[model samples]
Target chain A: MSDTTPAVEAGRLDTEALEQVLAAPAARFRHDYLEVRGLRVEFDGFVAVDGVDLTVTQGDLRFLIGPNGAGKTTVVDALTGLVAAAGSAQFGGVDLLGRPSHRIARSGVGRTFQTASVFDELTVLQNLDIAAGARRGPLTLLRRRRSVPPEVEAALETVGLAHVRDLPAGVLAHGQKQWLEIGMLLVQDARLLLLDEPVAGMSQAEREETGLLLQRIGEQRTVVVVEHDMEFLRAFASSVTVLHQGKVLAEGTVAQVQADPRVVEVYLGTGAHGRGSRTAATSTEVE
Target chain B: MSAARPGSARTAVARPDWWRREGVRLWGGIALAVVLLVGVAPAVLSDFRLNLLAKFLCLAMVAVGIGLAWGRGGMLVLGQGVFFGLGGYLMAMHMKLSDAGPGGVPDFMLLYGDGVVPGWWEPLRSPVVTVLAILLLPAGLAAVLGLAVFRRRVRGAYFAILSQALAAAFAILLVGQQKVTGGTNGLNGFRSFFGYDLADPVNKRMLYYIAAGVLVVMVVVVRLLMRSRYGELLVAVRDQENRVRFLGYDPAVVKVVAYAVAAAFAAVGGALFAPVAGIISPADVGVVPSIALLVGVAIGGRATLLGPVLGSIAVSWAETSLSEQFPSFWTYFQGALFIGVVAFLPNGLASLGGALRRRRARGSAVPEVGPASDVRPAAGSAGGVPADPPAGAPDVTTDTVDTAGRHA
Candidate 1:
């Protein structure tokens, strides 16, 4: 998980991936911080996200949790340039506001949709290849792919999709598809990952696996998860930001957020408290 | 077991399996086509039939471009006639000027207007300038048009209609400028082509060979583009435009490149059509011919490399043979064929092989992801289901379930 880890297999001394990483210093692991100040998004006359401010630095596995229509996704959308917002979202010394989505992505910020949007017609390897090809020149893109980049190969192994590397993405299982999307971000060299409901339709076991995968990925970058599943957040979140009615309600550790009165009121008073599964513990009361 | 997989990645990379299979097939198909067009057709068919075949090859050139733009890039180009007409008219103008000799006015100008060649027509007096204009004009126009349209996010049927409207407008413009464009009569009656006597059978055969060579080269170029990383990106944009953007790609740029390439190909086809068909007119470069070009591509299978070319030639041949006896029925038949292909076989005739293989695999209880035909998803599956839908109702979740089941 650290930057010093060898890019290739442990015993392999020289490989294409190792050589590639060595030749390209920019490919080395580097952390990027995301700073949002007074972020607001309006759909016509209705404000979807209003005056939300947050900061996520290196190794912060911060969770953005809120009830339905509480503007959890709208904040991520504002940061990723999916929606026109009036605020400053600074990432890696570049302002994400007023820029196109692809330009925002080029500035080391990547995001995944609630529904995984991997190309269904391409193979798993081809999906990663496209993500890895952002820096390639036009003439280079015209030539046939002679070899797989080390980062793509590593991402394949990380997502547990090396076995199905050549299979068309459409035939992948639901959990596998989500992992493929994350793996794509990995090869894309995204420093800030804003995942929106990554495990929305996953089974219990798949949820745990995705949580562990996020922890491993968060070790060298800034990670933000927008989740409605409180149980999953409580289990894996190092810190949490609670959004209520288009604004940040609370920001702290899992226990601290649970103890905050304003977050409890927003979750319960909004009549959306019993929307998800609740355990016997009082911490589950947030659900 | 671990050791066994160590070099597997390298093995996969070095094998070039796709190139070995599809590449070999492509080259072999081209060689066979060259043999038939160069050797067999000339020996067996009469000069008149050979000329008609050459004309179809020129039309097939436009289909090649459509295969790239509509088939791979999902642009739904319904205005290729504009590019075709641009190339054809440019070449026709050059031939007319050469026949009139330097400074002498063409017969059309003498008959229709004051005896003076238009300033625009003067530049094409040089064969070099004419060739360059034929090559660049259509592509340049397409590039500008594509950038403006795609950047504003105009696509789907809106893009199609815009292209069709351009074709319609182009035909009207030609008609309005009768003094220059030859109006309804169009441009014809050339005694020679590039200094060779058109009246000579030897020169006519030479033109056929030239058209055949150009078509073969076009197929090769398209094949190379299709196999490159750009090809994958083009299809990626087609299927998921938003996803490609999030991956740090400008979908507009990708679309513009494909559209411009298609335009260039159509232009080349048009230039050839003028010499082979011996005419360049508003009727040939209009809305109906544009649709006719698409019908061939749709029937051939837009997604495949050779599908459009072969399908184009087949459809043109079919029209030549069937339309002569039942001229009225040909239009209805073409329409019906296009409708059936879009409805039942959205991937066109090329996907028939894949569908048959899928069925046989299902029967044998084997999951076969056949590499032979690397066909993308059904073109119809890009957005809507294209079949039956409950009117004005939201079937979002239901549709999701249905698609997931089908994929499984």
Candidate 2:
């Protein structure tokens, strides 16, 4: 895998470099930012997520990495209104604490389920079409579904599934299904996207394609990915948030977090030290 | 295994463009319907049979709405009988009052309603208000009910139970209000409709024609609605409700509107049914008929455009004929038929074409029957992973980082 780090800055990248970054997987895209303070999620008195704070900016491809119960997915779920949440979350100027999930989605937030929850029986094109026009209401019942907007067409191309648009989503390969779900987010004009394990079950080549697609999407939208693939993240993530026991343990660039004593202790003791190497190494060698 | 798919590809091109390749079936259906309803029924059948057919047509209207609500919207609306009964009773009351001429209580109302028209019966005295009530009452009830139930996120079988309970309650209330409602014997003996003499054979024929025409119009209207964007949204909600919610749709609103449309359709059917059958009773509006309506929809293929209507008419016709053939056991025959269809043709008769085409491929595959029986909610397991990693799988769960690409 390519080890080149992205030239991530606070503001917009120029168009020439932006286009280049959009083409390459490891390049950064630039400005929707998210700020969270004192976020807590409790289920039946068990604290699933507790007192978490994070700041993320545009094209800020941040990775949330932890063991199974680290509360990474719960944090995303709370922001998307899946699980009950308390405290404050501000994304693109909207307070996203207790609003309904649909409302949060309409407020420009998008999320994907870990199990890849798509309308499996529908054609890929129909899946995107429904999401593309998700805001339609009951009064529009008499009106025919209009033509696919250019955004959907662009998303089809971006996810590289334009040719298979007529195929049912049930038959899609695992990686393609993941991309199609992301394509759904893109079609909804979502500004903030929370992806749950995007690269899981993908082939090595498919992972590379997804990383490039994620980078390309980040140029236009802020993406927060919850993933366990550290070797994949090391090459692609400009920033990383390490979680342990329902709280953020460390937040920094990949090398910085890897060097932190607490992060090393947690990961090493958990026997995850082999997955996330400190320096550039063969991508598949550890696996 | 090597047979070509002839129509699926042409579904997009090289076909009459109106309904796409589906247009062929559409035009054929219209032709068949016209021949059967217009040309053949009046010419061949006696007036008694014709009236029975018209009554079946009215019931088909209810099936149309049920197909959309229960079949597509996934509401499991076992309370449609309540809406149907309400509309029928409203129309029957208006007719009974009108037939009493002026300043007189209806014959049955005099006998059982304590010789006084209830205050609520006064508004239905005008034909325009009666028509409007028939249209709005059920729709309004459904809207209120849908809003309350869906907002609470009650769905699947619980919604079914709630709706069935509503139907039972409605029937019970009608029975208990014997003074106002003619008791369980119900309302009947209408002598006229508006100013027209109901005793006149021509007027009865006209009413029959009206019911047939209304059924046709409703089918067209439902087809238009099904072709629209809302149809796609409805189906999406059915397949993956949470996914639709995350896509920025309130699943409750989508469900409520569909439920309301169903209620409206059932209302109209009931209004016509009272006139054609010359009666409206608690017997017609109870739990039994509600299940009967769904049985037709299930037999016909709930999702197909013409399935519900045709299935309803066929089932009603079979009831008449089979009962004549086996007077004591026809109900059992109907039950057996339903069981056979559910067991063998689960997607309904509409899918027979696809099933025939797939016979070769089917032999090697698991024989799955019935959409109702086949498709189920995704197992509670998320992609086969438990909500939490079980203690047994600690190697994968405790060390997700070390597992690398093996995250569940």
Candidate 3:
């Protein structure tokens, strides 16, 4: 776990260095930034995600921490075009709100489910190969893959699953499956990654490795992780957004949000509202 | 496990030993099939039996498409009969036109209609257009339909129902157009096929060879597809469509390609069926025939490359033999066989060898302790099976369990 410290520090420094060096194209970078405004999602009469505004730039290891039903996942869903969203989400100069999910993915956005959804019947290498084949034409897809691409090989090494590359993903351990899903995102060259509870069921060692992996990746890409584990968030998050009941409750560095009075109140309260019971249930589940 | 290390080595340079062995097994399996289909069956069987075998080969062609679509892509395509019928009708029309001579109307039109061919049937007089239409029309229609349905994320039983309805509607449409489609009787008595006399046994043998040759080519094509990157993507789309979508692929497009390919294969099968069976009718391309095709695929092992082909041939042979002996029992027996395969062997008969091997491993070896034991058998037996079985039979079993649990 301590070894992750140097990588995290280096990641921070690299981000600052990139900020200064790429400042000339700062305007261009801002155009490609993920900027969401007044995003709302409704399921029947129930508002799952209320008017939320978020701005995630490159090199952002942004953590979205909230209690259950706080609409953290819903916000991610809206951005990924999984749900119908109102208002505007501009990513890479394209409005992501009404576009289909695949189109959003085509515009360099990728996501992973909490349960680590992977092609279980396919081997790990094949999974990565398929992910790397997004821009491949019909003819290329039809032809047999004569060689494993360098990017996929690199991803396998980075994810520490090179030994099991030939095994079907179905047989992968839970932690390895989550890592494989992340590896898939890497091979896709996704500019924006929205990971939902990636370390939910991982062991401590796996969680530490994941934090280091996220830090390493967050150096160049924008990543928003919807998380429940407070310790993991503290270890890796550069900045945090706290949501309560479909609205943004607070936003700042982990220390800053931890210090925020309203955030503390939400975390501790067992008030008259139904949120008390829900928060209590969820908080008990969070280690 | 000794071979496992090399199999895990980088695919480009190391060229895993398992891969080489798999190639040998694949081509070897095809070679065996070619021998049986082209050489042995024709040589051994009588002329009538050879013709019957030719018809079975035509039907097996449809199964190849089904294997790609339903087996690999996880689409329950229940309307292949529509495409099969399209091909059969197209070929039949061409044959009828040829028999009537250039620019002359078919004899059926003279008898059933007002002695004039409809303009739609006129283009089929040109062999070139007929052939092209036989190949392209069904595929085009399937692509269009696939785009419409898959884009909207319709799948599972709903897709099956929609496809089945298409077959029903097509049959109804043909029945209603009595003058054009020859009512329920449909078109029959194709005396010639591409200038070859159908009555001549030599020409019939040539037709059998043609069907046999086409079936082999199709199997090889499907085998290539199953080994390609597209095959991996198709399986991925089947198991986790939403996940594939996030990987920057339109799952709908992946699905459409497979669906269209399946349609094309079924169409070709139907095209060959017309001349071989000496008829094209609604009965041959309706809800029942479509289900029959599916049953054969299910029984043979839809996922395995040759499973569908073998299953189709076996089922057709059984139908011919059993129906002759006991007509009423064959249908019930087919239903029972489908149920038995789905219940006892969800991966189809192709997976039976793998299953038996696994059982023997479990029984002979010390009782396997945990999840660690699960992967060893799969890795060790990579080139062991002749069907080139897909990975993880246990995974599919669990998938079935999940589906059942969800419904329950």
Candidate 4:
């Protein structure tokens, strides 16, 4: 956008970077994982996603930024195997398209819900214990006790939730619930963490802590955060993909995208809160 | 215990220590249950009534299972009677065969016009085979059913309807198979239990002890399950299934195992019920009876460890007394009791004492103040931690806020 690239001027995709990245993504990446190609999701006769391709290198925190109804969550839902999707979604070298949600999660691709979804009745320790896959079998129920994994302990300590480890999760506030969910994904040893609006309901200070938390998590796992918070994305997202109407509207640095005349006029209206996802699911009509 | 924070903090503070208080309470409850079961029942009840209580104890075994499945796992298993009936019939067939001696058909088969024993019944003529069938047959059925339903992700009311339909179908099938199962009248009038003559009052008392022991074991097993990590996972599945799945747990496997255990318990109950009740019929293993098992649990508190057992016995006792007093209308009275309990005591009778205690303690608990911050950001540290206080913050009021707060 800043360079006056002809493809942006012409109102069509400049597929050079997307194609190059998808084709030989392994050569350019540290972790070099998560290649999605021509992924399409449909419901009834409507196409929610129409021929979208993405390649995420491991350990890079890529922010998937888009307006409301841009099929950002649908993308995560597809990768998480909650929807009937066509085309390839691969984690490392393994296909993720047809696997169940639990299998995909167990296979190192962890996802949090649009709303904070933690087990409300379970204690913080119990919640993390399940994510760590500790003593889960029926016969294993006979075992007197299992020691807490060191990693789980570290996660609770890191999230600042070690004190409330014994209290039921339902007692936690909104921000704490979000942090707890992320902690759950961390304990799952998720290689790729897909977080949807990780800071949606948090206050300014909590958002900062969460942003710092996400940045720290990004250092370890490949995190693809689907958020409408452009300011938060601008603060931490090193590379960004701008989605509009179920396609990659733009892809580059936040400054580059903000500078693009087409992007300024066509998307990112009224800053971050304009393109919200509260009505994102039903209001969007498929092409 | 605060209306602001609904955990067991205020009570914990009042006690000597958290674990000791909880440990004492748990052990006290267990000791009291054992005393009442072992000491008081035999001394108080007549032989006829004690036998009835033993039958109810077997019913309570199934209720204990229902507490785990329907209560903890959020699986509404209305077809437990399928397993219960199968075990009862298997045990009955074995006992009848044992009574008939070597290489002989049961008197019912001969007198009821089927002069030869069926091939299926022949294998069950062996007591060992019968015991194994009682243990494994119901489990196998439940495993298959649980796998099919849960793997397909069928849950909630659909699951309830499916289980009830199976129970109905099983009862119909049993009713149609008159020669083998003894049809509507059911298999009864057993002469012996493991060669102990049924006529002997001492052996009858032994049967009561057996029922009592088995129920105690089932309660303890269920208590262990509820306290275990897997038990917590089952409750988690019941609450937020998709969340559990995303946490890399197969909610289906968790559900299936709980269902199978529930089935096994019900089957065990049925096996014991045959020896104690001296009968098993379509009337006792149909949709009505299956739902009847749930009534006590619902009244008692399905989620609590002792609630289901205590509630089952209490309901059975009430039914006995009320029926003697008003034979025709006792069922309606029982129905009213169930409705009232469900409406008023949703958490059941087990929580009643806790609720009363909390109400009384509400006024006295303004005594303490600890700062609302733990090094763990205390919600206040983060400056945006929203509504409840941070984890270690002491709650002063022992107000009545439900532990299971409603979620969307």
Candidate 5:
């Protein structure tokens, strides 16, 4: 009976400790807001996302950097509920397993896809209006009854797109469209935002602006950003998680992760010729 | 959800609110036109023309359904003919049975060598049963079909194909069931509707007025539905289905409701069509005729409120007049017209007025506002940012670079 009592006490103590850990603010160096345990995604026996564990804590702008077939997007898909996932994904004590993407969205997680999904025909204001979830009924008969709240305008302003609000979303610049998408995420009031390659093809200036925008957005919310650009990661992300062959090879500050032998072996090994040139260019730019 | 931030305030823009001010004016104009045409035509036109107009009104009822389901909901419902056929067949059967006298088979059935009416047709002999069936049957079928298809998440081209196939199958089934359904000939040759003598000119005119009144009521009902929350959800589902789902709306259920309403409207139209047209045949309930109905809607601009009704009437009128004048080449001419409209005017004839108005306004030297370039600097940045590349530029390569940079 004494032995059983200690075991029960130990179980209770462990649960209390777990709860405390979940509730406690994440370390400044680690921004993991959500943690996945043994996530296994299969497509007819082809294991696209094999038993993988990932942690995305708050305040940590961690990069899920990997090669082409490394399942970074699949991990994002699983987290967003776009793809069915196996095992538990614990976020703020809620188990995000077997829930629909919309339910997941309502549960304080917002996501942007690799491709833009804005309505092409609708105006920029209309796009934002639709995303705002203000219009309640089918037709716009009562739409005029309730005016567009100031908050919606602020979101568009935040994205630096106030001037062309009346223009169709289709006419906006590519960078502006991405920003508009981010604005949509902002309107959703999600605690966590998942960005999939937000800066894939912008100019250096655009990329810098994006980096600044991400850093600003990250101050108020947890942002999980995936990218292939090491320079951008170094500039924006506080921490980095290197993925190779569907598993985390290393996770630390940009310099620390860059120095890790395994990360170098996997990321830099195949591109031996361009490594020195790129490194020199990066060092010169920093200086 | 985070606390509401004050930074999210939007600047109000001053634009001519067309959907509000101009929309009312346009609707008012339409109302005036209806008053002048429908209200005054009865006083001026012959009874025969008035009755023909009433039949057209019945067809307009079917158009209302097409507009709601296909235009707004984006459901390409080619099986509306099935509902229309159900209503017409039910009404025709009732009228035929009423004219046959108690315990007697209909005149056509007796002449066609049917000694006894089929058991399936027996229930329709009662006006109550027939009327109930007319309304309930089409809606019931639509509900069942909608449930099956929508539950499976079948949409787009697959949904269109499935609905068109249903129309074809319905027509074939009716044609095959000669003894029970009157086969390819269909139920027709009614002598009376609800104890009114069909031979009397006054009665025919009365039927026309009834159809016109019913059409007006249907339009009002559809307008109400379009203005309701359900209508907003329907359009939302059409535009951003995933987003609507995320907003906690089951788009399937919304689509089904819209589809069922459309089926009910079609059924009512079919019921009136039987009495007014004096015939309901396989030709009216088949795939070709179903496509013809859709053509009218597409020609008029399916999404526009009055497009379907006006388009259907116009097309029907053209077919009647052209066939009277040039029967052999009228079908070819109609096909050419449809092709030209689809190819050249994708938005349809309803948009023509808007386009013409815009052109005329432009011709009168109305200065158009160049694109606005007064974007405020991004929050936390005092420096004005340069204009970025347009989002939906044809150049995919540029987008790839922008996306890469933004994510990086």
Candidate 6:
């Protein structure tokens, strides 16, 4: 390895290769809706998101991929203002680094947790209506005012949950709940959507559907998804940023990054990049 | 793949047709019952009995606030008694000042220490000032306290402890301020309200009606709140504060608003309670009494629309009647009742109706399979299902674990 290309040359090889990678149907490159600079997040003594610099443009479908404990979620948490960060995270023109989660949300950065955050006791429509910010006016002063907005129905329709709109979110299947969470994000109409492992436990068919859903959503807003499932990532991600030890290991098109030797050693290790894995390496090469 | 999954037996029930169902019919019947009772009770019951009911109504008013804050907002508001006491003390001070006439000191002030009323108590001498103070003081205190605690992100057991400490501190302060607060005895021995002689039977009945009217108004107001967007937000804040924050709303502000509204209602109840109960003692504003108020709401079904009111009234009635019959055992009996209710009926008595209906539906729909027998596995495996578990169930961790496990 030492007899090989220089550090900068090796880095540029992956970057150049990544640029030539083909875009997936679900994942399209966003031109820079969010710009994060020198981001640093520390937990007591441990650095979580260390000096990470990334940008997510409008309509960008970015993937934050790494192995477990790679601090990928920490970066997402910092972007959403859930965790305190010591660097600049600007969305549009707003600095979200020190702002509260609510302020960040108001500034058009919406997020979904690894687990569904829907109100279990509430009806599915109510969940969407609540997410859509319905019942938030002077009419809420009066008792018996409507809880659901007209947009709630539209959101449910988009998520293919209109038929079960009245059922409680708690009763929905695992995949349906994930869809409902996405519908909530959609209803919010956030400029930047942060999805944490959207297809973590879904069936193959469900994951495929979610990929299609993400593809549709990516047309309207920037979506940054943190996922470990390489198949789903390959099927959805246009631009993948491989994170390892709180630093960006590789950033470019999936194919270019997959061919990067550094990414293979750190991220696309034996488990993720087995020999003869067609979807893992070959698809990226074809792109 | 075509075979029905054995574990997928519990499907989410279709949304209830609230308008066309018996639920609406049952609600209608309850409304009718309330109307009939209100209409005929005044004429049929003795004045003494009516007065008691009025007092119960006032207590119910306080419970309404408790229901909204603690029950729905997930704020364990242990200092509602502070608001209640504030209202009662204000009203009592005013009535006392009036009875003293001109510049004369209230009788308690002369007997205890200084022959002059305190400057703080001076404003409350006027009926207008007293009523306003009664309404504003509790709400103001609650708002300040709520802002401080909620803004700091203090919730669950910490919030409960903070509120309870406030109540304890308030009661002790009042007790220690003998010169101004009338010490442990508290302000009492009122002769009249407005110009109406409180001693007169008709006036007493009128007070009862007023209290009843106020209780009804408070209930309606809370009902409206619970149904409104704010109500939904309040519940959402209770269920998932962080999620609510991520939805473009400040959870602290929302919680504080609900807490303050609840405090205001409790103040109104306390003000009326002073006149009807004929006393405003430190005992009424202390920690133990505050817990007692929560007991009623919890037993009644804290989250339900009418649970707090019904539960409060029922508890108060039982306390009065039981204490009168067996004063020695009443406290112990009440404790037992709370323990039993909390243990067996975790959702409160209000949920019994819903539970019974569910049972009946299950019984009719699945005659061959017993619902009771299936409950264990259904509960065990229903990780993704969104059933409203009983209030006391330790389901918070379960939900978190299931969610994490699904994704992991």
Per TM-score, the best of the predicted structures is 3
Question: Backbone collision count in every prediction?
Answer: 0, 2, 0, 0, 45, 9
Model 4 chain B: weakest 10-residue lDDT segment is: B399-408
On TM-score, the stronger of 2 and 5 is: 2
Query: Please, what are the lDDT tens digits per residue for candidate 5 over residues A1-287?
Result: 01111111100012222232234244532433688888888889888777778776676676777776678888888887778889779776667778876667767777776776665556666666656563345445323325554555767666666677766666666666777777777666556778887876655677777787777667556788877776677679987777676677788887788778887777744333345555633321110
Q: What TM-score against the true fold does each predicted structure earn?
A: 0.86, 0.85, 0.86, 0.85, 0.76, 0.84
lDDT of 2 by residue, A1-287 (tens): 01122311112112333243244233322335788999999999999899999888886788888777999999999999988899899897889988988999998899998888888767788889888886655565458856766666767766767777777777777677887898898788778889999988877777776787677666666889998876678768878998888999999998888778898787534334554554433332221
Candidate 4 CAPRI classification by DockQ: acceptable
- lDDT of each model, Cα atoms only? 0.83, 0.78, 0.83, 0.78, 0.71, 0.76
- lDDT by residue for model 4 (A52-148), tens: 8888877677888776788899999999988989999998787899898888887788888878888887888988888877325556655544787
lDDT of 3 by residue, A1-287 (tens): 11111211111112232233223433434445788899899999899888888988888899997788999999989998899989899877778988888888988898999898998889989999999999999899999999999778777777777777887877777778888888888788777889999998876777877897788677677889998876677679999998888988999897788778898788523321233243433332331
What's the true lDDT of residue A243 in model 3?
Answer: 89
Query: Which one wins by DockQ: 4 or 6?
Result: 4
Best lDDT goes to which candidate?
Answer: 3
List iRMS for all predictions: 0.6, 1.5, 0.6, 1.8, 4.3, 2.0
Which clashing pairs does model 3 show?
A: none
Q: lDDT for model 3, on a 0 to 1 scale?
A: 0.83
Model 2 segments more than 4 A misplaced? A1-31, A137-141, A268-272, A275-287, B1-20, B360-408
- Could you arrange the candidates by lDDT from highest to lowest? 3, 1, 2, 4, 6, 5
Tell me the lDDT of model 1 at B363. Answer: 39
Q: For candidate 5 chain B, which ten residues in a row score worst on lDDT? A: B4-13
Cα RMSD of all models vs. native, in order, equals 11.4, 13.3, 9.0, 11.0, 14.5, 12.3
Clashes, model 2: 2
Alpha-carbon shift of residue A155 in model 4 (angstroms): 0.3
Show where candidate 5 strays beyond 4 Å: A1-33, A44-46, A85-99, A132-145, A149-154, A160-166, A200-221, A268-287, B1-20, B97-137, B217-233, B243-248, B354-408
Q: Compared with the true structure, what per-residue lDDT tens digits does model 2 show for residues B1-408?
A: 013233332332344323234666566667777777877888898999999998999899999999888778878888889989988998998898898877678898777656988888888888899999999998999999899999788998999999999899999998889888888978888888887888898888888888887887788777877777788778889889999999998989889988998998899999989989999999999899988988888898888788899889999999998888889787788799889888998868766655653543333223224332221222213236444323323222212221221121
- In angstroms, the error of model 4 at B334 is 2.2
The number of the candidate with the highest DockQ is 3
What DockQ, between 0 and 1, does each candidate earn?
0.63, 0.49, 0.71, 0.45, 0.13, 0.40
Taking the tens digit of each residue's C-alpha lDDT, what string does model 5 give over B119-225? 78789778888878888888888888898898677999999889889899989998887776778888888899989999899888888778877777777677767
DockQ score for candidate 4? 0.45
